[model samples]
Target: MKKIFFARPYRFIFFPLAAAAFLSLISFIVMHLWNYLLPGLLHVDMITFWQAMALFVLCKILFGFGGRGKFGGGAPCMRQKMEERLKHMSPEEQQRFKEQFSNRMCHKSGHWGRRDWFGEEAKQEDKKAD
Candidate 1:
């Protein structure tokens, strides 16, 4: 008779054990760095190991999980939607739409020092015309 080996039971135990070990090591590094640097440099109190772990968790919460945001890939999805909409428009309509959008963006405030999308020479010609 052959015996069947079950890998699933081992996987469940291994992953949590690995994660806990990683978190412990990271937290220990955080505690030592904070205790070594901040107290003397910033005149702040040194944190305990648990406090370091909490600080790491707090940072992960406040900033993100290392993507653009919580949901991720926002800009690419928006670009795809815009491309789908543009595909249905005729050439003339697309040109008109692009011109209107470009004009609105160029005239808006707080865009100083950025090169025009049309290029530097076109911008100089526009300045000369004005």
Candidate 2:
């Protein structure tokens, strides 16, 4: 069983099957409890309840395995990879990178610094305006 789980070909099928079984079991217990508590809350018969439970399980499997592209799917994002690389850098390298990034951004946006917004330069401009 462990070997089957570790096998590449079986893994894809195994994960969704396991997830669906787990979810279905939980759903079944919840539904049973709800039925016991309210009896006829939704007027749901056994057949209809089972159908709804199966549908819920199917949706869980599809969204969990298919939606996120986790099961050997989807192209990975470059920005995420770059951010991971940056995070692994030394503290000195990080500070240098941050300085370069801020300088570039400030140059592009024509901002001197955060304090420059309301400091002596802006105060002088305001006095001249008055």
Candidate 2 off by > 4 Å: 1-7, 40-49, 52-130
For candidate 2, give the lDDT.
0.65
Candidate 1 C-alpha lDDT tens digits along 4-88: 2363467668889999999999999999999999999999998999999999989989987765553435588887887898899
Off by over 4 Å in 1: 1-6, 68-130
Clashing pairs in 1: none
Clashes (backbone N, CA, C under 3 Å), per candidate, total 0, 0
TM-score for model 1?
A: 0.48
Write down the worst ten-residue block by lDDT for model 1.
Answer: 1-10
